[model samples]
Structures are given as structure tokens and as C-alpha cells.
Target: MKHLLTIFKYALLLALSGVLMWYAVRGQDLSTIGHYIRSANYFWLGITMFLSVLGYFSRAYRWKMQLTASHQTVSYWNVYHAMMVGYLANIVLPRMGEVIRCSVLRRTSGVPVEVSLGTVITERVIDVLVLALLLGVVLMLEFNKFWAFIESLFVDKYDSLAANRDVLLSVAGIAVLLAFVFGYLLLRNLDKLRENALFVKVIAFVKGLLAGVFSIRKMENKSLFLFHTGFTWLVYYLMDYLAFMCFPETYSLDMKAGLAVLTFGAFGMAAPVSGGIGVFHVLVQSTLLVYGISKEAGIAYALVVHGAQTMLVVLMGGISFIVSAIHSGKPAAQKQMSVSR
Candidate 1:
């Protein structure tokens, strides 16, 4: 039943991606998009992909720093392999890669899953903060260009929410009351809960997670970690900026435009869809539209840029999976041989 539910979940997500994809390309001329894609400067894209590789390495090293601060002595390659494998998994399954990567690290480095998961959560929180910061910066700088588009996205929803404000407030109040009551009950029963095996395990896991999350405070080279973080985002921005040169329509776009793409595109990728397939394309296309680029050309650029990055992940990730798998099997194979002897 659990397996069935997992399958259903992925299937539903996949269907949603398909629907969004159709909506994105619905009125566009495929041949025009194809023409734009074909005419793009492949050399710039190649450079972008190379920078993407650098970004991946920097990100893995950053993660290694986090793990080291947590006192888990995982090797750099192991972390890289696990991270790449996780990226590969995400191409097929949205958000599942986090747990899968943590599991991989546990298998390879003997790191506790809950600890790694906590680090993952910390990483996500930091990323969200950075993205939000960038989004704010872009919106502030390009208010005239982006305000209408941004407003269009939220206005309808905001209106609906305002219309139901009273009911929503009542529901929210009830939720808070129930949460408080539940917390009170849990506190009253804390001693009995501590006696339960499941509760004990949960407590242990939470402790490990907290340890991992706080590991950043114990990092030895905070400056280096910050450098890596900045470098990774720089690479991300360059990927968008350089990709602009790939097509004539976007070639004349400036640094601020690239920043806008990086900000909005990151949001698109953060959406809960496989590889951010449909959502990224749509958001990127819409964003480019704000810059006076036609939807056809914008989507064409999105397709090539996203396609190249996706290919890179698949290629690098496939190799990482194979290498990690072989290395992981060695210990078991040696153990079996020892048993036979």
C-alpha cells in the first residue's frame, strides 16, 4: 500500500508537469521555437555548462564543510557522488532526492540519516533566504518592468483570500486553539511518552537533527564557506547571463536582466515538479516577456538552457551513481570473500 501510494504521488506530479507544459507551449509555433534553438550560439552554452560543473563542485564542497562541522568525516568524493546521485534522482522525482542523498551518505560515510536530513533542511532554509533576498532586490530595481506581472500572479488569489478573510480567520483561530490544546496534552503526557520506544527514537532523531542544523556555527573556515556560497550563486547568475548570448533575442540583455532571470528562474526550479520542467519554462518565458522578448524566443532560450543543464546532471549523475555503487559494493564483496575463506 505504501509503494502504491508513492507511485500514485509521482504519477500525479508527472501529470501536473505535463499539463503545465502543455499550457506553456499551447499557442506557440513549434517550428519557430525550433529555429531559434537551432540558431543559438552553442559555444556560450558549452561555457555555461562548464560553469554549471564548477557550481556543482562548489556546492558539494560547501555541503562537505557542513558535514565536517557536524563532526562527520565524510570524504569529498563521497559527498559529491551522493549529491550528484541526488540531483539525478530529482530529475525523475521532485524533492525525493533530499532523502535519497541523505540515505546515500549514510550508506557510504556512516553519517546518521537524521543528521544529514537536518543539514539538508538547513541548506534549504539558507537557499530560500538567499532567493528571497534576490527576488526583493530584483523587484525593487525593476519595479516598473515586473510589478504588473507580479501583481497579475497574486492579485486574483489575494482577492479571493480577502473575500474569505473572515472564514479564514476563524479557521486559523481554530487551528491555533487545537494546536495549543494538543501541545498541552503532549506536555502533560511527556513522561509516559518518554517511556515509549517510538518516542525515544523520535527524541534521538530530533537531537541529531538539531546537532546537524547547528553545525554551521561550529564551522572552522566560515569565510571559505561563505565564499563558496557566493561563488555558487555567481556561477548560477553567469549561467543565465551567458546563456543570454546564445540567442539574438536575449543577447542584448544586461546584467540586471540576468539577475532577474536567476531570481525568478530559481523560484521556478524550486517548484515541486520533476527537474522543474514545465514551471521553469513557463516562468522564464513570462519573465523574458517583461523584457520585451516574444514568447516564442523566450521559450526557445529556456528550452536550450534548461535542456543543457538537465543533460549535464544526467551525464554527471549517471557516472556518480555507477562509481558510488561500485565503491559501496566493495565492502560487501570483501566480506563475502572473507566468510568463504
Candidate 2:
């Protein structure tokens, strides 16, 4: 029933977005939009594509580094493949990449999938810190008069879209906090929490998870982490901002707004919605509209931006899969990655 409801909700959302796209596009000449899309700066699209794909690989490298493996020297080849698989998975589900990527690495390297996955959490911790830091900077700098509407988008109670967003974010925060609390208490009182075999198993599972996350116990690999993390975020913006030229109206938006769009894009894509389909489009479109672009142009901007990004990840990841298979004889099932130390 729950799964059915989720499917139904997504169906509704997709339907809604389709309607909005139509209305926004009501009187607009799609031929003009097509011409705009065709006349788009292909060079920038190419650049965006390259950077986006490169960034995911960079993310893979960081994940490999976090493992602190004795056999793997953060093989770009392996990381690239796992990242691709993960990205492809996310195109279907919400945040499923962490586990799927872990599974891929575990199969290829004989690593404990759980442990590998834990390290992914560490990677995400770093990512979250960096993103939050960036968001803070962007908010502080752009928080003047220009930010009023966007801020109200968070504040306004009468606005359905605005209200839904804030509520969703709040709900997510609550759920995360609840999970953390449950885990902490369960761990602290394992004996009591283990009133049955299932309870004990759950406790054990959480312990294993905690262990995996802390897998890089004594490894001091800050340089690699900095390189990968910095590069991942840089590419994120490069992918988001540079793709602006793909549309007609946003052709002249400043670099700062591009960064702002990236910021907004992060939040938009953070939803649990499928592939972030409706979520991503709405956020990107709204952000552009916030900057005075028409809704029609905003939708166009969203499509071009996301489509370009998808193409980049899919193509690079597809290539990565082929290379890893043909070049690396490794079965992707080994538990211990051979570090090049």
C-alpha cells in the first residue's frame, strides 16, 4: 500500500508538472524554443558535460580514498564505474546510490559491502559540510533585498509550493533526527533493545553500519579528500551554471546567479522523488523565474540544464563501465581493495 501510494503520488506530480509546463508554455512558440535550444551554445554544453562527468569520477576517487585500501590507489577506473552505476541507480530511486555504489565496489574489490557503504556516509558527511558551507556563503552574500522573494518562498504560508517545500524539509530533518536518536539509544542499551532475535539483529546491523562509516580509522588522507571534494563541488557548479546558455532567456544571467541556481538546484534535487524528476524541474524553473525569467523560459532552462547533466553522467558512466570491464580483469567482488601505498 505504501509503495502504491508513492507511485500514485509521483504520477500525480508528473501530471502536475506536465500541466504547468503546458500552461507556462501556453502562447509560446515551441519552434522558437526549439530554435533557442538548437542555437544554444553547444560549446558550453560540451564543457558542462565534460565537467559534470569528470566531477562524478572525482567523487569516486574520493570514495576510494576514504576506503584507505592497501591495494587500490584510488583507481579512477574502478571509481568511475561504481560512480556510474550509482548515478544510474539514482536516476530511478532516491539516494539509492550509496548502497548500490557500495555493492558495486564490494563485488569488484572483495570489500565488505556494509563497510564500503559506511565510508560512503563519511564521504557524504564531507559533501554535506561543504554544501552547507557554500550555501551559507551564498546566503550571506546574496541575502540582501534580492533574496526577499526566495526567502518568502520559504516563509509564506499561503503559497502551496512554498509551504510544501518547507514542510518537506522539516519533515526530513525530523526523520533523520529520529533515526539518529533511535540508533544512539539502541546502541547504548543493546541488552534492553535486544528483547528478541530481531531486535538483536537490528542492533548488530546498526553497529556494523557505525563501524563501516568509521572504516578509515587512522588513515590520514586529507590531501586526496580535499582534491576530490573540491573537484566534485566545482564540477557541480560548472555543470549547473554553464548549462544556462542552453536556454534563450537565461543567456545573460550573471555568474553569481548561476551559483545561486546551483545552490537552489541542490535543495531541489534533495527530494525523495523519482530521479528528482518533478523536484528538479520545479526547483530549476522556480529559481530562474525568481530572477525574472518567464515560467516558459524557466522550464526550458530546467530541461536543458538537467538533460545536459543527464547526458554527461550517462555517457561517461557508460564509457566507464566498458573500460572497467575490458581493461580491469578484477571481478568487482573482492572485499579488500589493493591500495597503491
Report the number of the highest-lDDT candidate. 1
User: What is candidate 1's lDDT per residue for 180-247, written digit by digit as tens?
Assistant: 99999999999999999999999999999998888899999999998998999999999999999999
Reference-based lDDT, each prediction: 0.92, 0.70
Q: What is the C-alpha RMSD of each candidate to the true structure, in Å?
A: 2.3, 5.9
**Regions of candidate 2 where Cα sits further than 4 Å from its true position:** 1-31, 69-76, 158-201, 215-217, 246-248, 319-341
Question: Lowest summed lDDT over 10 consecutive residues: which window, candidate 2?
Answer: 332-341
Expressed as tens digits, the lDDT of each residue in 121-229 for candidate 2 is: 8777776787788778777867773477556676556566665887889999999999999999878987766688887776676776676677566457777678777
Error of model 1, residue 58, in angstroms: 0.3
Runs off by more than 4 Å, candidate 1: 329-341
lDDT of 1 at 53: 98
TM-score, cand. 1: 0.96
Pairs with backbone N, CA or C atoms under 3 Å apart (clashes), candidate 1: none
